[model samples]
Target: MAGFANLSQAARTWSIGFMEFDPQNAFNNAGAVLRQLSALLVSYSLSFVGAVLLLVIGYLVAGLVERWLNAALAHIHGFDLTLRNFFSKIARYAILVLVFIMVLGQFGVQTASIIAAIGAVGLAIGLALQGTLQNIAAGVMLLVLRPFRIGEDVQVGSIRGTINEIGLFATSLHTSDGLYILAPNSSLWSQPVTNYTRNQTRSNAITVRIKPDADIDQAQRALIRLAQSDSRVLADKTPSASVSEVADDAVTLTLTYWTAVGDFGGTKNDLTKRAKLTLDQQGLSKV
Candidate 1:
């Protein structure tokens, strides 16, 4: 209140000096005071107008962005979350940046030179971090093609593990041995990748042995029966067992079965165990 009273008096009273003044000097001093007051009012009005205009434009842009996001990103997973953050902040900041630049231009500031200076600095920084820039580019490519994502068990180069995250420079994986590995994006992009979980089914080949005296026909029948009876095994294609090789004391047989991905290992182990028990009961060799 005190400050406001003092400013009000300052604007109201503009006597130039205590000494007597000529008419011309008196007119000049009063003109100077009125000009200062007019400038102050113009500055305040423009600032208020800019703020209100910014709010209105911001609201309208927000509505348009929301509608466009819904229409454009309907099929994308996590798109709402991603673009909600991206657009709201990016658009509003862009508006503010433009407004600020325009206001500066009105005050006789050169924006092009400022922009050029920033670009030059960015170019220098990019050149200094060339390797990091390549990694970021590779990461973008991987994300776009989506060769593998988090939770897929993949083999890249000599590394085999479930991917945990994909970042700007590296992909993190959790190995079967319970170790975490950070693979550079450049390396991942350079290697051949195999994603095991991409398919719903997996086939495994099991090698078993039987006595030479045992009927090859009976052993094949038992192997097929073992695979068929197991609920996890896929039976549309018949499980096959054949005399693949002849060992010194046993006939080596190869049994191949198709199973669901989740049951691959368990089905193989169960089938192998059941084949052993059936062979033993039939007096086949333990080999």
Candidate 2:
């Protein structure tokens, strides 16, 4: 019986000892975990703050660099505004991308892995956007080669318009009839482009028909006088009149003249109207 009583008491004492030891051990472990968590939080907080500061500084620098690059490019002769802006924006975005990579590094990201992943994504995107990429490439070539400038009249394939804007993927144009057109850069670049106003002077002709009985020499003289009266006509080219066709019903006289490109339209229109009136006054035509 004494042995049994001692065993019961010892069992109780062991249970109490375990209860007390477990609580103290648990509390120590919890304290240690909290301390580690707090340290990590403080360190991460500092890194995050630093990263934000770096990003802000990077953005400011990017803006300044873009502006500086634009200004520098402006001095080069034949360097277009579109190209300058495009290159400047490229520089700015490159800086931002680098800053983004650096920011990720602060958070323990592997830059090499990131770059590889980005390259993979870029390749996939390039494959998916083949047509868009082609347009962009064509736009770059157009901007570099300068086939036409803004406000210049150009004809591409069946499209005829004045260049409004040249973008990274498309070119905007205003048609002669006041219609707006957005054409892919690839379309413009791939086709033969005819720039009407690129040259200083352009030759234009006006043909007038006179009655069959009308004196051919008199009609020619009248047409030449009409061309010469216009100040827009280039005196250096020396206006000439030729007999285009001699038919039983009527005789056709062709007046060829050179004028400044800017005034070509007005000069042609004026000469055409004056030629018709002058022929009528000279009794050269019935209608």
Candidate 3:
């Protein structure tokens, strides 16, 4: 009976010791877990705050830099407004991109890997949008070379209109009949472009068919007088009239004159009408 009591007491003591150890170990593990969690929260909070601050500062800095660049470009002589805006926009985006990368770094992200991935994506996108990329490239060249400017009348391909706006990928035009046209920069850059308003003076040729039996000398004189009387004609450029072609039906009289570029269309129409009237008065009938 003594031996059995001693065994029971020993078992109870072992059970109590095990219970105490288990509770102590569990408490220690919980404390350690809480400490680690607190540290993690602190680190994450700081990173979040830093990233937010960086983003705000970066945005403000970008705006300021853009404004400063625009002002500086405005002071430059002969700088195009479109180019100025484009460059300012590029600068702002570049700064913002840098700030974003820095913010990512603050969060322990691998910036180098991200940049590489971005490059790969950009390359893929470039290949997919080859035509669009070409237009952008052509637009940049157009802005630099300045083959034409806004508000100028130009003929590109089969489209003739006045340039309303020049954009990064396309150009807008307004036609004489009140139609709007959007032309890709690539098309304009690849083809021949005729700018009607580039020069100050334009040459006009008017051909009038007169009866073969009509007095040629009288007709020529009348044509020259009519051209000289027109206010739009450049007086310094003397008008000339001659027989260009002789046909079985009639003789073609050619009148060559110079006029101000702006007055070319109006002058040509008026001169043709006046020449017909003058020929009629001279008893010369057009065939």
- Clashes (backbone N, CA, C under 3 Å), per candidate, total 0, 0, 0
Error of 3 at 3 (Å): 25
Clashing pairs in 1: none
Give the runs in model 1 whose Cα sits over 4 Å from its true position: 1-99, 211-215, 246-251, 283-286
Candidate 1 lDDT, 1-287, residue by residue in tens: 99999988876565534344588988999999999999988987886677667666766776676567555655676443433444455565666666666555654579898778868998999999999988877886787678887788999989999999888688899998999999899999988999888788988888778887778888888887888888888877678888898867889888888888888888888877888887788876445
Q: 170-255, model 2: which lDDT tens digit per residue?
A: 99999989999999999999999999999999999988888989898888877888888888899999999999988889888899
Candidate 3: tens digits of C-alpha lDDT, residues 1-287 = 99999999999999998877877779999999999999999999999999999999999999999999999999988677888999999999999999999999999999999999989999999999999999999998888887889889999889899999888899999999999999999999999899999889999999898998888998999999999988888999999999998978798999999998889999999998888888887788574
What would you estimate as the lDDT of candidate 3?
Answer: 0.92
Please tell me which model should have the higher lDDT, number 1 or number 2.
Answer: 2
* Location of the lowest summed lDDT over 10 successive residues in candidate 1: 78-87
Ranking by TM-score: 3, 2, 1
Question: For every model shown, what is its TM-score relative to the native structure?
Answer: 0.69, 0.71, 0.77
Off by over 4 Å in 3: 1-53, 77-82, 213-215
